[model samples]
Target chain A: MRPALRPIVTLAPLAIVLLGLFGGGLLLGLLQSVGLFALTGSDAFTLSHYRALLNDREFLVSLALSVWVASLATAVSLLLGVTMATALHYGSFVGASRTRWQRTLLQVPLAMPHLSLALVVLHLLSPSGMLSRVAYALGLAPEPSAFPVLVQDAASVGILLAYVWKEAPFLAVVALTMLTRVSRDFDDAARTLGATRWQMWRRVHLPLVAPGLVSASLAVFAYVFGAYEVPLLLGRTYPAMLGVLAERRFSSVDLIDRPAALALALAMSLIAAMLVWVYLRLARQLVGERPVLF
Target chain B: MTSDSASPVILRGVSAAYGDTPVLRKVSLEIDAGELVALLGPSGCGKTTALKVIAGLLAPSEGEVYFGAENVTPLPAERRRAPMVFQKALLFPHLTVAENVAFPLDVQRIPTHQKKLRVAEALALVRLGDFGARLPRELSGGQEQRVALARAIVSAPRVMLLDEPFSALDETLRGQLRLLVREVQQRLGITTVFVTHDQREAATMSSRIALVLDGGIAQVGPARDFFTKPESLAVARFFGWQVLHGANGNWLAFRAEQARLIAPGGDAPPEGWLVLPAKHLFTTDLGTQRLARLRLAAGDEVEVEGPLPYVAPDAAVALALDPGCIREFPADAPATARGW
Candidate 1:
């Protein structure tokens, strides 16, 4: 087979499937948002839905809330992930059996389904759930209700916790792989050159892992921004995440709300597209034309 | 220039093991200050392990490491201040050549101006002054190694450990870098330890060579001593000498170049030389010289190097082994080391 043809032949099937399903649905959704396709009786196209969404205080707040939660989750996960990965790589937590267990434990979240992890987070943080009961039993709170409304709290703390719990492990795995591929001699060289342990990480390991970490963080940020299950289970209804808002609008009994729902979906997709574009540009600057794993 | 004299690196009865596998056993050697010594050996012979022990990267299980009068056995590699240039240049890919060279000074909390001056001087010493702004990936392999050399010497380390730093380069580049390392070491007058499996490289780079066999020093002396007189049968063979089982179970070694071929019915051979009947098996032309392999009457084979117009295969030849070139191993020394 010709070399160029080989790649096209191999990738064609997958490309066709993705473009058919995802691209087709995205096009249909964009058109529907502009009143091109609708089950309701309105035949005229207008920007009213988008303009309404922009002006609607709840929709605007939901979009801002989604961005805030995702950013906070990404920042927390990146820091925790890199630290854990470094610790694991250097054997700060050791013993042959224990090291294996620790590695597996660190990656457990990676294997977990998002909905399942969200359920666990909800149970642990809800007023009447395990953590609240434990706090009450320990006399830290007079009752479960006094433990603070972590689950479904207005701040989306429970949602952030769930996202961090699941996503940090993925970023940690990326960091660990990058660390393992790099030569340990660089660390030794740094130390011999008079660098302290912190300096070694700051100077050697950080630079080595930064590109990979940024790519992974962008993925986590995008996912957290668009993910629905965690926020649905753990977020308040007043300022729901964009995904929840879109879902509620799309599932409403009235059929006229469909275009607005599609509008929100199109907006979210555009935001994700912009994020990916920004990541590509930044990745080129950060990692230099090296083939990005993402 | 280095203010302090080269710190004598001493490893007293050092032994190291990786889990259950012993790599070095009770290895003891002392290198004088300002001396460049090559730890020469085959791959997996623990020469690198010994260098690491001296650098304080690996603490010996049963011995002490000393830098001059200071017993630095407990010191970390950073505390010992012995920088190593690894087989790969290992330049921090993220940093420019200047930053890499200035890393040690930066770590030591030297002022920015002093660090810049030293980095510049070090890069110039390595003949890579113009490459300071370039990243390691931007440089050629030889240039990367030169950058690594600059980094190693920028701090005026107490001891410089080179772990086959030029083995990755081509032969021509290897020779050039070898000379560069020698010039830099002499100019700085710092003690250096070089590890290499290539005999010619070791011989060319160091003032003295320590032949490491089975994880211990088989012999240590001037480089010529290894060629002229190898202390053990293994060392002789390692130097490409032909070790043969001679009269009454004695092991003897002879260099191919020292063995002369004569007619079977020639006049009496010289005194102190052994005469043996041999059949020529093959001969190869090596440009300036001819090498012939012969089967001895005792059913063993030996090689002889002589001028061209070499003998043909299956021809009868009388072999005269020069006495000066032959050395007999002690009766108790193992005839051949197990598993090489």
Candidate 2:
């Protein structure tokens, strides 16, 4: 009943639930990846599945594809999101009530379910879909078949399109929060110091918002790197995203592939953690003493 | 580059409104080049609005602003070349002290070597030369404000607008920075407009003080003129005078320091001096002076400031007010009348 023990007692139940569910699952995943689980019919830990995955060309190709898709999507989304947020912030202050509604309308995509957004992209950008029909009608394409194969393309353009549409709004909302927190005095100071509007944004406003952008962009990158539904619906069959390949291998008819699937999942988690670490280090160097999430 | 080409700023009946609320109304004032003026007033009196009007941050709903002979009404803040230091330091959190000081030069696209040299000089002028590499959050409140001052002056601006730049600091630091600002303004000879609610700050820091009342300037002259001869009863009250009624029904006002304490039943003061009977209520010791609250026989209260060792509470005393220091306004005169 001591006062110092009160907070610990209050948090005990939540901690127990988290440790029981998350920590227990993580331990089980690690054991299964090392071939120590009951399904592997062995108590001895082994790295044979990981070794096989390292040499397997398909797994390596899937890993590279997931990295490429997530990196490109995150980078492009960050640029677009920061630009949109800055523009919205500047525009929203003019006719405050009307442009406030405009800012709210831009957040419609943030509420959308990822799978639903992926399906929407697939329906509109497919070779035989709405865009192709419009292109053919306008004589830009001779037929629906002449339109490029955007949906389920080998380069994952369709998946990238869906992700950018979904996650850019997420980053934009975060960026807008940062932009609004900056005081108007700083902007006035910059302007009075002879900075043009563009220079003020570039030198002062952008640096102020970079901390929030860097942290939020890392979240988007990690999410897209390990996300499942969008890539499965929009990606090609041969060089699939790691998430898609891992799920397929886990559910295969041959039970021996289960360990390899677990290992690949572990690898994805490791890479995401590494990416987060690298990002935090770079952000600290750039932002100087501001707390950056790892 | 000609010396006489720099325009003295002139505001010809400038007025501004926010939505339907009128903040400044038909306010006109002229400021000469290389002069430091303080817009002194209570909060919400449009002191800051006037400063912003001159800085081109706020466009007047009516009237025009001229810098020297050129109409600058349409110019934006970025084109005005007048930098401002805000009430708070408002140093950019992401930038180091050196970078913050160099911001104006960067905006001007001045060469890097000159920018570095000027930044160093500005920092040194603020006595913060050793702290330039530190981030703003790493510095103390006073240091942050010093850095902001450095940043404001580093561009060698044509004019400087200071909006209560030292209001956030302690009294001692405020006085020190006030002196620093005065020295820098005199040394650089940049036309400066400082906005402050503190009368003492306005008096100490500015060559002339403009007393703002009810959205317009009531009087503009040397700081001594405001204390010695306020033009109206409102200006007297704004200067913290406790107005007392004379025998003839004229309103009499004098500063706390203008009254001299006399022995109870002592010989009368010199000719033309008004001797008032009072009872001491209480006194507070300020380091160099004692401030006593005294009530006259007619139930009017007045504050008196004099040398230390104040009389005991509830003791009978006499206050001799110099007729020269007493400003009288006729009973029927309006608050805006020019009462001397």
Clashing pairs in 1: none
List per-candidate RMSD values in Å.
Answer: 2.8, 3.5
When just chain B is superposed on the true chain B, each candidate scores a TM-score of 0.95, 0.89
- lDDT (tens digit, per residue) of candidate 1 on B1-340: 3727579988889999977788998888989898999999988899999998988778788988999999999988888889899988888988889999988888888999888889999999999989888888899999998988899888888999999998888999999999999999999988999999999999998989988988888889998888888887788888988877788678878988888776455456688789888898888988888888888888889888878355667989877887777898765676543332
Q: What does candidate 1's lDDT look like per residue over A156-235, in tens digits?
A: 88998998898888888899989888887888778777788888888888888888788788888889889888899899
Please report how far candidate 2 places residue A224 from its true position, in Å: 1.1
Docking class of 1: medium
Model 1 shows how many backbone clashes?
A: 0
Model 1 error, position B301 (Å)? 2.8
TM-score of each: 0.92, 0.89
- Per-residue CA lDDT of model 2 for A103-162, tens digit only, reads 787799989999999999989999878999999999999998899999899878999999
Q: What DockQ score does model 2 reach against the true complex?
A: 0.77
Q: Fraction of native Cα contacts kept in each candidate?
A: 0.74, 0.87
